[model samples]
Target chain A: MNTKELIKANNDKRKLLTKETQKYYEDMLIYIRLSYDKSEHETEEILTEMLDHLLEAQEDGKTAVDVFGENPKQYADDIIGELPKIVTKKRIKYMGMGILYFLAALAILSALFNVVEHYLLDLNELTYKIYLGTQIANLMIAIPIAFLQLIVILHYLRWETFKNINKVLAFFIYWIFGLTSIGLFFVIIYFMPSFGPLIEWNVWFNLIIGVVLYVLARSVKSFI
Target chain B: MSLRTQLLKGILEGCILAVIEKQVVYGYELSLKLQHFGLEVSEGSIYPVLLRLQKENLIKGKMKKSPSGPNRKYYYLTDEGQEALEDFRHNWEWVKQPVDQLLDRRDNL
Candidate 1:
């Protein structure tokens, strides 16, 4: 057959296979997504690859079960079960980095608060002591929130939607918006009159810490 | 999993590496070759093996344009894959005798 004819024939076969096996493909994809939290593109690629095999088998007069085996679900489970050890290792690594980001964020924020209280805020000794206690109280609330935010960001990064973008670029874009929103939040907190005395530090500790963490996070791109 | 499936799972990675070692092949062709070797592996099952091999740095896949079709992801063995195949060969040789002896004794029984 000519290339055109072959292409048309292959396309027709693929369409037919997709239509006939749509339900199985969808089910398998759902199972994979639920089990592994894989991206849609990933699941689709797998389904299409399997369909290619199914098409080849169909051409040979075999059914899906004949080609895939008696139990499709079991077949999928086996496939996932046999995933490379590197996948798990990488995930654990990401989790580790996520924890580090959480801790680094907390450290930087704590340092920022210390500089603000110690140098920036204008108050008497007693009020300053009160402010320090309040700052400690504020951290108790902020640290957990920061941790949760980092986790959400990490999870969002894993989504298939960002798969096409360069990892470093994607990470920067997400954090640029994230850190900006956070900066705005602090600005709002700074301006609140009823929120008690607040101070802003002019030193470069926060910037330095932020830059160091950003560089460290950017360098460890294996997990993302 | 059944014993047969378990055994197949154990060797499937080496088998796939061996197939890619012979020639650069895409997913469909690789599946066909596996079938030709009398392995009753499903087309779906081969992908996980391919993915895992790629992850382990044993194989590398590149998308090459096809004249009659869209880009096909073709796989080739990396140096690591070659080294892994060599290791599998050595390990298989070591295990083969005991396995053969066990099977022969079963046959005799």
Candidate 2:
């Protein structure tokens, strides 16, 4: 048969192909055509290779659709379905990572609290040092704030809202963390007058904390 | 095509050019030619290859209005395409000669 006839036959068969399979064939063809100059025999070989990938895509799509059924929308909604297990596993991983992130922040904050008391305030030496109780107070407040930051980050990453909306939420979370940290810092200083001129290192440390909170909040947003 | 598919793309182009050399054809028409021989390539699959061939100045296409939806683009081999086809045809002969000869020698042995 002539080339036109051959092409017609191939196209007719192609018309019966499923959408996912057709997409696979189209993608493979695009790559093949773009990458190299090929011969007719080679073209046939590429088509065969594409046929394999198409079959694979068809199988995968079929399995996914079958397991998930039609409207298994959210991960929670699909708990009864087979595919929800995978989504559940991923969600669990995200939750674990988020908890770890906040815990790390709290751990650092707790350590810094102790350091500020010993180095910045003469708590043992002065009467105002009575308010040294505020360091533990800061830790108590920070633990919950850290949890909120994690959620905000997760929301951003998940694309639950428009990306810009998530970003705004992340910004607010950081602002709260930053202002609170600063407020706590100055509150300690306000009560303890003997606390020396704020050290260059302390200012830098606070700035670093602000930046870390900003980054953590943004990073979590992407994860959500 | 497997990993060896890269070797066939040029050959596919040569084949398409050879086919178009005989007649002006649309994208669908060319795909039909591949299919008739049991090659099983899809209809939309050939357009990108056609576009690449045209970009290399090997084939030229013109738009023709159809009674259906959109204008159909038909491609024909240019002089440059013919020259490339001839060159590919020559290289193909040389490449196949050794393989054919080996096969023949094996049969005799």
> Recovered native contacts in candidate 1, as a fraction?
0.57
Compared with the true structure, what per-residue lDDT tens digits does model 2 show for residues A110-171?
Answer: 44665667678844221122333454455456566666754555444434321235668778
What would the per-residue lDDT of candidate 2 be over residues B39-99, giving only the tens digit for each residue?
6654434544665686688987665654554334567788899999999999999889778
How far residue A102's Cα lies from its native spot in candidate 1, in Å, is: 22
DockQ of each model against the real complex?
A: 0.26, 0.01
Number of the predicted model whose DockQ against the real structure is largest = 1
What is the Å distance of residue A96 in model 2 from its true position?
47
Give the per-residue lDDT of model 1 (tens digit) for B1-109: 6999677776998899888988899888888898899987766678778777876899987767655575566898999999999999898899998889887855663
Q: What are the C-alpha RMSDs, in order, of all predicted structures?
A: 12.4, 18.4
lDDT of 1 by residue, A42-128 (tens): 444455566666766677777776666667677777665644333565666566676556556765776667667667694223122
Instruction: Give the distance in Å from residue A201's predicted Cα in candidate 1 to where it truly belongs.
Output: 30
